[model samples]
Target chain A: MAERAYIMPIALRLWHWTNALLMILLIISGASLHFTDPVIPLIRFDIARTIHNVSGIGVSVLYIFFAVWNSATGSWRQYIPELKGLKANLDRQNYYVFVGQLKGDAPHVVPTPEQKFNAMQQLTYIGVMYIAMPVVIVTGLAFFYPELAPAQLFGFDGLLPIAVLHYVAGFGLTMFLLGHLYMGTTGTTVAGGFRMMITGWHDEHDEKPENEQP
Target chain B: MAAIKTVIWAAIGLVLLTTSAIAQIERKPIAPEDLKNIQDSNAKCLECHSEGGFDTLNREGVDKDKLRDHLVDLGVYEGSNHGRVECKACHVKGFEEFPHAADDKKQINWCDECHTRKFLRIEMQFDESVHAKEGIKEKFTCSTCHDPHVFQAAKYMNSPRDVVRQDNDFCLSCHGSDQSFEQVSKEARPDLVENHEWLPNRPLHWNAVRCVECHTPVSKKVMSHEILPAEKAEKRCVACHSADSTLRLRLYKHMVSEERSRVGFVNSMILNEAYVIGATRNVYLDLALGIFAAVVVFIIVLHSILRIIAAWVRSRRNG
Candidate 1:
């Protein structure tokens, strides 16, 4: 029997979709700017620059809201990996993804309100949100306002270091997105994770706990 | 015997007439109409100004280096862009007589007479320059930097490397030496290389860009001729090295059309002319990025393929 639970909130769902769309826009526009003579004419260069800057600002605002909402709702804890069960959880998830899923075995963990992300997802999210995103944002702003960047930082003069850092961080975020997209389809159904994101409800094949049984 | 004597006298008279005509053609001052057709006026001027005619020592016994300076070398002047322009075109008031009058010698040639129409914008910039602002117009004429007799457009030079070398030389002619600056201006001269020690590869930077590019405020077409004070000069590399570099906006503004400015992040296509250290895109970096992205996608695709094959094999075994 499948038990349906309301895990994602309406506000969180809106933020997620908005953030996803903005990321796509930013990536496309950013790529257009970085590659002077891009093969695909996604958009005009000037338009791309304008859109990229606007989308970057939007992402920054959304990120701030996300931080505040996560803190307020205690959902921030979901991203912090539990050190005690981390090794076991990672091993089980890896085994299910690499081996057991191919043999049609059930995944080790089910989605819960308090524990949304798995151990691996939690660790990866932490790196992306805390390290990569911040690096990209800081360096992007540095590029935008070159006067603020130090003339010489760690032997690099001017905006050279900022540009390099921004590229590296953006590249990392792209890699993370690729992994995230692939993993989204690894749930019970091909579109199961996507459906949950849209509806704020997920169906699991686990029984209701005795304490919460009605 | 009488017929022979008459023939000899006539021959002598004819020879004298031919010699006088040749002297008239060679020594005659170029008329306003004739000036337009003359190929080499500097050579005509050098006919009298060269070697024996003009003395280095003047009537007052002062070594008038300034007066002797007007003397042109036919060899050098012949090779210049200005070689074709008649001397009367620039030295308008002078040279109606054998010795030019005092007022004629003192007459200032206005560059604006011709330059105003072709380079009106640059002329306007020059009018607003610090030299003009300070009323040092007499001391800082066009001839100060550009020797009118031997000047050529830097772009038309043999190579880009020569262009850079010549452009820097134009500035260094005055600023490079303390004595030159002292002779020209009342201001104390600063050591050019020492003042620019903050910039890495100072000589390389000097070679790559014009001194006015950084020292003057940005303009529409030409770089502003108004040299800023040392403290006011642009120190940040990003001012010219960034996507919205002022160098492009001012120096290469024509290259950035309305259509192109609207199309890309960088306003101008001329950015591809040279590798702009950090501002311009790198092909090697792009290739690396492409390889990295492909590897990431390949890993995910390979893993998915393995999972699919494994699932199919298991299902077949079960069946």
Candidate 2:
């Protein structure tokens, strides 16, 4: 029998869908704002700005709830990368996705609650949360303030650090997101992970191929 | 013998008049001084032109340089409506010699020589126009608006007068009545012109978004909100929006756009106000929004820090 554990939680699934939908909206509006000059996709500048801010605020609320739940349940540990033999595991992961999977090698290890993400996946998700998301939100706020809000908050001097942090985070987020989408598709089945994301469970009864290749 | 003597005297008089006419003459060209032997004196030319050559007087002691430069200064005259006429043709000699006296009749023009019917028609119209009559403002001569010598006046002033008047503000200068000029500018027309006394028609006025949110596209980083003035914002959102305009300016925030106070966002308002403060100009939007943003960030950051601390404390307790 294929091994399984307490897979994705209902609460986690709710958060995931909400988060994804909001992000799609944010991306549409954000891309509209980013590619402002060419005048394709997004029709109006002000409309783009408004949509972006609203999506940001929505994400803000959703993240607050997610953070609270994660902290409470102690499930955030799924993201903390293991320190021992991390590099070799990362190498195995690289090989599995890039080469070994095509040669029918078994996965390095089956996913468990404690070892849900591989070293690379753990690092990438952690990087996004700790660095990327915060920075983008901060930058969006800075723009709003510069465009429409007041000047004297924690003082003019504090805003510069905030602005710089935002840009750095935005760039990091870009790199992480690009990599995440590319690698996310390479799970056990072509749509295995995506199916789990939608239905909250992977099928348990598929027979192992005598010469299994990804 | 007596008849022949009379004829001789008349002939002598005719010769004298001809030489005098030739003495005080100006042609299409000035006297050609191509040769060193010729003397082209400006004072003599100004004598008849500045004063009355038809009378006995001309301008007194005109400087040679000033007279020579008059050609450049008065060069526009060649392009004028009276380009064909010689100066002396109009400054016709009265019944006088070179040192003749002035009579008002000497300055008169022979209107019959041009268009007889049009001249009389204009004279009747002139009596009706205030300038032609007793009123100083209404009285405008044919030469008042038009430069008889040079028609270049319109060329230098950017565009024709009508187009300048067609400007958003320029048209409103005279047309504004019930509405404040600020409202007039913001509104497309007429409706903004209507809002001076009354607030806008509530439902119609309520739908429009704030002006700064849409119209001003200059990047916020470089936006110069340094010139706020005492008069109030001409570009404010409510100006163009009235129930009356055919296209209809929209107001109010929709599902996505959250427009706020217009003046607070508009750089034009800031610049006008900063004008009085002289050197000190500050944009509050950058800082205020900055602060608001920081507070939100700080809260999230504080939560994250607390979470980390609580986790450490719990682990310590367990250990």
Candidate 3:
């Protein structure tokens, strides 16, 4: 791949931060609702519902905008993983994180606009957007209208299965957040990814070309 | 701009006039249609309750949690048999206008208004029965058996399967356990389980001998302005005791209690309460966990498939 530079587009920047912040908020409030503590009720468990509801709207709206921008601008194609070198690149990234960087390696394959995301990032984001979010929303609807649903809640005659599905979706979202937090630290510096998400500008690494054509 | 301002001011004044009329939630005959308009009124009940209330519990932030609290309140309400009665049926003259300043529920008398026959029956029966007639301190009111307002059957556990799942918890509030009934059954007659083998021979299966089998259902249907005397209460004892020895032994070896049921029997009632509640609660927790797990597994599988497809397409394009 040729040396290239691609300043993160403004729309992409906004969507990224909005999605990241909203996901964090969801995990916090969702955790609090399912498992609350005795002390420090910044807001009561009742308000966890409000937080979950409003933040859910925020995340979903941003997701719609992000999807539209990706499709319209044809940037969604960038997520396509290199089938042949996927294992090699993933291993290279892992080695850099673990011990290779300490022993002074060239960090395997160089980062490029064509392959902006590592294999893991592509996989995680795809699942969160397409699968996990819809499950959470549907389960939430189930909890809200258990009686008016396929059946009444107090009776086991029907709708018992929906209730169980609701909890599994909740726990799944919890697991997603935990893994997401661990991956967040893998940027160029100690707090590089955190800084980039906040300001929408990762510190320009000297070795890699900054200018990349779309 | 000047003419538009005048029209806008007039509209604002007219809106307030309409709202003031709607605020009187005590509007009588609170039909289903009225509830929609009531909810749409945009009146914040929390505005006053959170700051000013006779009881601090109904104060600020009260309305925020009121929805969940309503369900919890239903539990307490059922325990008192007030569970059967509707709140507004006794509250204000109308549901919308339910007076916020007082305890409207307890103020209205239940026996004279709703359960006159059962009330009169108690008065007539007590004279010849077990209690010391004059000095019986524990007064049994109309609600002793029937809660005229909120009276409702447990719809969830109204089935045999639901009852069996919960075992005895559903009706434990009124009935005792099987073990408790065993002691009473021994006193009445031995061969407790073995004798009652068929459908009719179950534990605590007392035959209806004296208790009126066919009576009009007593709901809260009060009618005033009639000078005619109300129907008299009836106590037809010996429905089973006097039905002749041969018939009595066929149903029971003779444990008929025209006076009162054998002691340690109320425990059996509580056991039925357990069955319904236990069945419903277990169903909820189980179903909640199951779907929750399935959704997760489904998402994971989908994610893997999508990942493989995306990678394959990319490699083909490159080739």
Write candidate 1's Cα lDDT for B85-113 as tens digits.
66777787667454675688566566777
Candidate 1 has which clashing residue pairs, if any?
A44-B263, A45-B263, A45-B264, A45-B265, A46-B263, A46-B264
lDDT of 3 by residue, B230-310 (tens): 122111112211212222122121112221211212111221111111111233343565576567667655644654565
Looking at model 2 chain B, report the run of 10 residues with the lowest lDDT sum. Answer: B272-281
Give the local distance difference test score of model 3.
Answer: 0.43
DockQ order of candidates, top first? 1, 3, 2
lDDT of 2 by residue, B4-48 (tens): 999998777634532221011133454334311221232243344
Candidate 1 local lDDT, residue B96: 49
Task: Please compute DockQ, using alpha carbons, for every candidate against the native two-chain complex.
Answer: 0.08, 0.01, 0.02
> What TM-score does the A-chain of candidate 3 achieve?
0.73
Q: Measured with DockQ on alpha carbons, how good is candidate 3?
A: 0.02
Winner on lDDT between 1 and 3 is: 1
Alpha-carbon interface RMSD for all candidates, in angstroms: 20.6, 27.0, 20.5
Report, for every candidate in turn, its global Cα lDDT versus the true structure: 0.67, 0.44, 0.43
TM-scores, each model vs. reference: 0.53, 0.40, 0.40
Q: Give the number of the best model, judged by DockQ.
A: 1
Candidate of highest lDDT: 1
**Angstrom error at residue B30, model 3:** 45
